[model samples]
Target: MKYEGKIVLVTGARRGVGRLLAEHFLNQGAQVIGFSRHEDDEAQLPGYTPLAVDVGDPESVARGFEQVRKQFGRVDIVINNAAVLTSQYAMIMPAGAAKGMLDANILGTFLVSREAAKLMRKSKWGRIINIGSMAASLEPMGDSIYAATKAAIATLANVMAKEFAALNITCNTLGITAIETDMLGQLPKDKIDAVIAGLPLPRYATAEDIFNVVDFFASERSGYVTAQTVFLGGVN
Candidate 1:
């Protein structure tokens, strides 16, 4: 288990990508702390402690990190997997929706990453994997605001990688197309069909697909792979 004894923090762990990520890390023997606004007691995952925190608020994010540090000596890895998606056409989207997207997707990621880096700096080695999306590059319909937030995540990874290189902290973005998650279950069939049709592989991503990438990022070989945006899309 590469992550044996390592303390890994994963945000948005109640469901979807985040939950899968936390499970994978724990399976690798990592002591994982999951932060989600909702409480998911039914999961009963081994070696995982769930912390309730609203990442969209800086205060909540900070407090969550404090709790993590208090419980686990140090945080070795952080997966910024928590995000909110607003799929609305640019012309019809209201200002309020745009603001909410910015608060949760962009600002929340910043706050969590910043706090996690502070803890990692003391540990001398760390891995920060940001969960991004193909929407940032593909610019899909009705995804303008969501795409903008993920693009900011890419930028955050670039700067954090350069700034923390000396401290042995690697920051990278894992950009992927749609995955089969409860979140995507909300979408209508036509929309999902259109996305799958455009995919070169003719299928959507799975939680396992995203987990493989995260595992790679947390490996020792990834030390030299900082600042890179790795696309999980099968096309290229």
Candidate 2:
């Protein structure tokens, strides 16, 4: 769909993949609202509003949406991209890290999607696209909590799709493979390389690769597409 007049919200918009998505939509003429836990210093572009929000916190999410409601009144698309990933064996993972993943990866997506849906229902047409991970289906070792959270998001989207069908809001997930982002930089290079080598498409996903799928999900033509998880690099 044309983003010329669409109102788009993207979580985790301070950096990496989320920032990329936000900027792309903004360039397409959408009025973009970006949520980041960090201060809103990076995005000063026209038609872009950066908000400080911790998606896992109910109050923060609520306040962020309130700002959007006052400023834009409705949302046309939402990208649930805020997440925390800890790649340690479950036995060795700290409780704090596990809880962080649960809060940010699962709870964050849940909060943002629901809040965005509220704004969307006003318009009676909306797209809720979740940013998921290959870890969800790959189930690699050393990512038990992280993987579980990603998997949970896909399931969350599935049920939401059913509930929101009549409202014209379609929910879906894009479980992307590794990309050269800060998130991937946190992992062990050798291990990541080995994992990529095993994939049918053994390469890092590019920005365009991600945009293609996101655009698909955000398209008006995809009204019938909901409750689906599309994984990249043949991971699914």
What is candidate 2's lDDT per residue for 1-236, written digit by digit as tens? 26998999999999999999999998888999999998889678999999999998989989988998898999999999999988998789999999998999898899888988887887799999999999999999999999999999999999999989999999999999999999888899999999999999999899999999999999989999999999999998
Question: Residue 21, candidate 2: how far off, in angstroms?
Answer: 0.4
**Can you write out model 1's per-residue Cα lDDT over 1-236, one digit (the tens) per residue?**
88897999898998988888888888889988999988778667788899989999988888888888788868889999898877888999999989888988888888888888888899789999999988888787898999899999989889989999999999999998878787677668788788668776777788788888888888888888899888766533
RMSD (Å) per prediction: 1.4, 0.9
Error of 1 at 79 (Å): 0.6
Q: Assess candidate 1 and give its lDDT.
A: 0.86
lDDT of each: 0.86, 0.92
| Candidate that scores best on TM-score | 2
